[model samples]
Target chain A: MKICVTATAEGLESSVDPHFGRCVYFLIVDDGSMDFESVPNESFSASGGAGIQAAQQVLNKGIDVLITGSLGPNAFPLISSENIEIYECATGSVSEAIASYKNGSLGRIEASNSPGKQGGKQRNGSSQKNN
Target chain B: MKIAIASGKGGTGKTTIAVNLAISLGNAQLLDCDVEEPNCNLFLRHDMEEFEDVTLPVPLVDKEKCDLCGDCANFCQYNAIASLPSGVMVFPKLCHGCGGCALVCPENAITENTRSIGIIERSADWSHVDLWQGLLHIGEPMASPVIHQLQEHISEDNNVAIIDSPPGTACPVIASLSGMDYCILVTEPTPFGLHDLKLAVDVVRQLGIPFGVLINRSDIGDSRVEEYCVSENIPILMKVPNNREIAVLYSKGIPFVTSLPGWNNRFVHMFANICEQLSTRAAE
Candidate 1:
């Protein structure tokens, strides 16, 4: 299964970006091989509908699972519709987040936690909650 | 002549000028184009009659015909449509109602449907002037559709029409200011007011509309606004001092022109001055 992690930078050592829609990079990892490729997020600076665009990009990548800090109103529906499993990881490096997910230690995000258009606000605790 | 009363900054007295000027003119048509929060009706004794619903054409995919071709999703610039392998999802709230998705669907799966975003109302009982306002539904992001509907009610017979425009230089404000013979850019003499007023000026200039400045609360801030106007050669149409009486009257939702009879003549004179400026510009 391929998993995508929102990251602040282009490497596994980079910290996880707390925003799904506006993350600087998306780290797509092949769980079987533990191999990864970092792709820059095109929707990071979109004027509006960043979440929708980001979700669409991830869906197009054939991602089976997503690891992010928070999902917004615009993105949650699109991601959920694709039957892609989502896990919440608000801190730690991209590799650590992937390990937690592999071990089933990370929390599954059941629904959208952040309000739409809160790109500038740092949303914590809610996305990190184990629900 | 049609004049739009617009302020880039809110609470800079766009409605105050619009209501008073329309009342003073007696034969003018007043339109409150701030659909999100229409408030011009508050100061006037008028009976409101519901006009019509403002609707936008959004696409509805016919699943029976749709093969999930992804064509409709690709064509939608607003990202309102998302085509997935399992099913297609349409986010109506994000839709700009451009109808491009329907046009692009080769399978003929997309169909157009009207979604009511707002409504318009006409006021009766305002002795001589006709008052109309647009009300945008809560949570509706677009206001231009309602403003467009309200503009359709502009009285052709009335020589003067005044639009109380929403604050800002965005799409809604552009919708309100479009096709006006003149725009009275009401502003205060502060940094925030000047900054937004410049943005508004850019919009009006781009639209190629003749405009003048009306400085509200003229005495409170610095003289930079006046200096800017003088340098730009933009006419300063009128000035209303920051008076305690006006503030008190505003808090009570009273138009000061009605209580202080002298202000009625002042508003009328301002209107006449605007007319004179328009005529002079036409001659040039």
Candidate 2:
């Protein structure tokens, strides 16, 4: 399965961007081979619907799953509609987040998360309450 | 001739000027374009039994026809539509009801429907002048749409129309001033008043609508407003002194022209002066 992680930079060491739509880059990692490619988010500075536009970009890349800090109201519906599994992470590097996801310790976000929550709130799919 | 009474700042006598001027020009049409807080009807004994609903077209997505191509999402300028991973999302509040999404949908999944934003009410017995007002539903964000509906009342029935424009230099005020023959910028002589007045001046000038200033409460504040008008070569058409009597009458919803003796003639003269200025500019 292809996994996409929202990140601040196009590398494994780059910190995970809490925001999904306005993230600087999407680190697409092959779940089995561990090979990775980076796609720069083109709508990082969009005046409106950055999440909506970004979701379409991810869908075009045929992403199976998305791991990010938070999901906005606008982006949540798009991800859910495309049948993409979503994982929420609190705060960590891309590598750490992927490791947590592989370990089945991350929260699986069943529904849309709140928009751009910075800290002390449920962000990751593993830690997020299913309700 | 359409005259829009606009004030850069709130509580700067826009309604006062509008009601008085409309009454002064007894035969003219009075349109209260201040849909947000329409208080112009307070002074006029106008009936409001007849109301016309003002609506704007909002798009509905047809799931059977939708291929999830995201064409409508990309076409919406207001970012009201989005093709999501789970499904599609539509934020009706963000929609400006432009119907672009419906037009651009490749799959023919989008259909347009009308949503009422406000109502246009008319005075059944407008003997002196035909009075019309736009009343926007509370919490509705789009005032310009309602104002656009109110403007439909304006036609060749009357040579002149007096419009009570909403306060501020935003989209609502622009809607009121659009295609107007003249704008009466009612303002006070305060720092805040002058600051916002400059903003309104910039908007009207940018739109290329000929306008003049009417300094309400002219004697209460400093002379800076007068100086600014003089420097900008903007005509100061009238000066309304801040008086307790005028304020008292306003509280009772009575026009200053009704309470103050001979003020009707003054407003009549002011209207004549505005006509003369407009004609002079036309000739020039």
Quote fnat for model 2: 0.23
* DockQ, all models: 0.22, 0.15
TM-scores vs. true structure, each candidate: 0.94, 0.78
- What are the iRMS values of all candidates? 11.8, 15.0
Candidate 1: residue A100 lDDT (0-100): 97
Error of 2 at B243 (Å): 2.2
Candidate 2's error at A63, in angstroms?
A: 6.0
- List candidate 2 segments past 4 Å from native: A1-51, A54-131, B85-87
- Model 1 agreement with the true structure over B59-142: per-residue lDDT tens digits: 888899999888887777777888877667888767888888888888888888888888899985666779999998877777
Q: Report the error of model 1 at residue B273, Å.
A: 1.3
Model 2 interface DockQ: 0.15
